[model samples]
Target: MYLISGAECFDPSPRGQVDVLVAGGQVIAIVEPGTLNVDAEQIDARGKILVPGLVDALTHPCGGGGEGGFGNRTAEIDVETFVRAGVSAPVGALGTDSIGRSLDVLYGNVMGMRTQGLNAFMLSGAYRVPAPSLTGDIARDIYLVAPVVGVGEVAIADHRGTQPTAQELRRLAAETQLGGILGGEGGTVLVHVGAGDSRLALLREAIEGSDLAPSVLYPTHVNRSTALLDEAADWALRGGFVDITVSTTKELIAAGDITAEQALRRLLEAGAPAEKITMSSDAGGSLPVYVDGELVGLTAASPGSLSDLLRALFADHADLFPLALAAMTRNPASALRLNAAGEIREGTRADLLLLDPAHGVDSLMCGGNWLLRHGEYLN
Candidate 1:
């Protein structure tokens, strides 16, 4: 048993000055400060801020978007990177470059990370539909593979996309929806909405005309274009999740385009439900700026951007818990249906983080294992 005390807890209950008690990789209890009935190691977190570890639902932690393997493909995140960033959970997906990407690879990767005591899950396939998968079929993979929780990175409007027809979109959504049903998960045909004027009409039509729930079809990178974002906002109002990519301060500032912070503001101002909004780092994925069908500049995505977005939002005077943290934690968990995560509470897995008052991660615990303490990793 362990007692983590002297911190404000962001458990959705949002209790201040409480102590968390963890036993065997789960939050055994949460109580008023100084209240506990067990002998345990102690972590004095006085004056520190405590928050549920963040969740990245749409990261390409499988290694993505770049050519070359081993040396060139980005390595999957270690426990330390996640802990240091206050991310206790990562929901991975593959991106545009799909060679060497497979369901088996994603499955094995998620298992390896979970074994090291982080809550890791993955969405199978990549930017093309008829998406890449394992077990030979999407539904079978979801049922047989523990980590194959969903399918996506299905590119839509980008030049890199398959430019699938509406019939193709409906077919894919139906297939994915069936996979989720048989697998007891939110089998989302997670779409990669793009910057074209076509926007998400195909998705809207499928949801309206079919039996699939609107919540099951997630659209990421909505902030990639201004007009496309307007479509995303409308989709959110109709009950779908929109994922904005995180940015470095420089990238966010220079973007002059929509940012996660600005998107959140605009999303809320447009009456998009706060909980319906999420943000992903798009880490290890590529951010390419194109002109006249030419690549002008390309920057590799980094896991570091997750924390960077939070810190930048702090400067904007936004509320951290309900707004920023939800995008990182609860929203993703809800979208992925990762049980007992995205919030800190009794009986939940102890996937929690301690942050400085300014919200920088200071320590992290995933599944009750302290991978990082005072900024150091046990692993």
Candidate 2:
């Protein structure tokens, strides 16, 4: 048992100053400062901020690369990488190299991470049209597999993708919905929006032609281009969700394309509901660079970039803090149906981070176990 005292909490909603009780892998209670007197180890957190640990929804935990070649395949991500980055939950998915990196490998990594004390889940399918599945069907994979919460990271409108038609995407989403209904989870189709000129046209048309709710299709990499970002804003206006890639924004900023801050600002300025937007790190995935339709080079994304982006936002864009925090925490949790995770409230999983004065991770607790203390790793 532990008592975290005198911290400004953000249940991702700014709960002012409070003390949180942790026991048995869950938040036992939240009380006023100095109000709880119990037998527990005392941890003073004066002048610090407490926020929910991040839920990165689009990571490639089993490794995601090989566009350049087999030699260029990125290595698998470690549990410490995410813990140090203040992420307690990481939803794994496959990308372009789904053939080499099977769903079995991804599922294994997810379960392995869980055994090592992380809230890990995974998506089914990849960038291909006929998405590869363990049970030979995506619906069965979601319904039967406990860790398989949703479908995709499915690539659309990209040169490397199988060029699945709008109808095909709709059918895939329907199948995911069916599985979700049976399994009692959100049947979200995590689409990888590419740089192709289609620019979310398929998703919009699918929504128009089908009875699926706009919330079922979640497109990522919406910040890859101005046009796509604009379309994403419109999608959000119509009650759909959009995901911005943290590593992609950083890479684009490095290439002198657009800064991370501006992409989010543009989305908000274009009437995109901030609550409807989410951010993901795409950690361990390949950031493949193409020139005239040829893979020239690539770089693998890392875990800390999501934390880095949040710290930067707190430092440079204070007004976006609440929305940004919710994006990385609560929003993804809700979308993926991660019970008792993502929020720092009583009866929830005790996945919390204490931020130092500089907004960096000072301490981290996942499932009532201390992973980091005083800015040092303990596990």
Candidate 3:
């Protein structure tokens, strides 16, 4: 057992100074400081802030970025990167090049992370209508594959995308939701809304014309353009979840019509529900620079960007810090149906991040084990 004492806890909602107890890879108790006495290892958290470890809903754990060429395919992300990024749960997906990279490879990578003590998951398909599936079917993939939560990073409205019709998307969403229903999880379709004139039209059609719930289609990269961001705000207002991609590269940031910071601000100003918004690093994916609809240069995204973005948000947007934290943690967890995995509370997983006074990650504990301490890796 472990006792994390005298820390300000954010169970994502400010629990004041409290003590949390952990045992057998789960949080067992939470009480007022100095109120609980136990014979267990102690962590002095007097000057720290404890929050739930981040849940990255969109990432490329098996590696992405073959846009430039085969030589430019990014390297697979290591377990150390996820720990350093303070991500306890990461949902991996394929992007533009799902051909060279296969679902089997993605599943292997996710299982590898699990072996290393990370709560890793993956989507079944890539950026195409006829997505590559491990079980030769999307529903079967989600139903039979334990790690697959949904189908996604599927592209739309981009030149590189398959330009799937509304019927195709509706069918995919229906099957995904069915799989989730059968598997007792969120069977979501993670749509990659690209920089095209069609915008979210296809998505809107797919959701509105079908019996599928708005939650069935989770559109990401809504911050790709100011117009798309505005549309995303409307989508959120209508009770749909929208994801903002936090880009680390200057080229990708510039490629977006607005910065992630600006996009968040815009979403709030547009009156979008705080709980319906999420931020992802798009890590390990390609940040390709397109000129005249052609890929001229490419750079790989970093998982560390998730932590960096949260730090920057807390430092600069104090008023929105709580909402921002939820965006990175609880909201995405909820969207991806990661129960008892995103918040710090009794009965929840012991996946926590202890932040220094500067709001930087100082220590990280996942599954009741310390993976990082004093800004250094312990395992």
For candidate 3, what is the TM-score? Answer: 0.95
Estimate the lDDT of model 1. Answer: 0.75
Q: Which stretches of candidate 2 lie over 4 Å from their true place?
A: 249-251, 254-257, 288-297
Pick the winner on lDDT between candidates 1 and 2: 2
lDDT tens per residue, model 2, 223-323: 77788888989999999888888786344655443445676788999999888888888998877667766666777787788788777777878798878
Full-model lDDT for every candidate: 0.75, 0.85, 0.86
Summing lDDT over every window of 10 consecutive residues in candidate 2, give the lowest-scoring window: 249-258
Best by TM-score: 3
- Candidate 2 global CA lDDT score: 0.85
Q: Could you report the Cα RMSD, in angstroms, for every candidate shown?
A: 3.1, 2.5, 2.3
Ranking of candidates on TM-score, top first: 3, 2, 1
User: Where's the lowest-lDDT run of ten residues in candidate 1?
Assistant: 247-256
Error of 1 at 299 (Å): 4.0
Of candidate 3, the 10-residue stretch with the lowest lDDT total is 248-257
- Per-candidate TM-scores read 0.90, 0.94, 0.95
